[model samples]
Target: MSTSLYDADYEALRALLKILRVNAKLTQVQLASAMRVGQSYVSKIERGESFVDVLLFAKWCEACGISPGVALDGLRDQKRPGRAR
Candidate 1:
């Protein structure tokens, strides 16, 4: 599918990721540090200014103390209504 981070479904995924990070009590900088990336990278991902592949998504979930499987399931359940799959 040709979707950007700003797409509704993609945005939902980003929101869920941000929520996971918040629930884990990690600051953007903290998560970035865990991911070995710059804070701007985390910010960009959280703000839907960037997209993450499955591998990165898995790492991100783990870095935030969330299970990658659970995270993907959450994103799956968040599929936008009236949007084509």
Candidate 2:
């Protein structure tokens, strides 16, 4: 297992979160407001510069109008090109 933020799974999480945000019609700034953080924070997470913890992930899901459970349901099958940590 790896702890790198740029890993494929993490990248998938970022992709999913960005999709959910767009689907929810929320901008990065809007999601940041809902998540109680600055826009750059959300951008960092989505760009894989920041490693998001479980609580933060849950908050992000809720901010995008979905439950953490729903987000996880679609996570496992997320595939992406491999990259070095």
Give me the candidate number with maximum lDDT.
Answer: 2
lDDT of 1 by residue, 1-85 (tens): 6886578778878888899999999999999899888999989998878887888788789998889999887778667577554
Give the worst 10-residue stretch by lDDT in candidate 1.
76-85
TM-score of each prediction = 0.85, 0.86
lDDT of 2 by residue, 1-85 (tens): 5667877677888888899999999999999999899999999988888988999999999988899998987776354236332
Model 1 residue runs over 4 Å out of place are: 80-85
How far residue 29's Cα lies from its native spot in candidate 2, in Å, is 0.6
Error of 1 at 3 (Å): 0.9
Evaluated at residue 67, the lDDT of candidate 2 is: 93
Candidate 1 local Cα displacement, residue 6, angstroms:
1.7
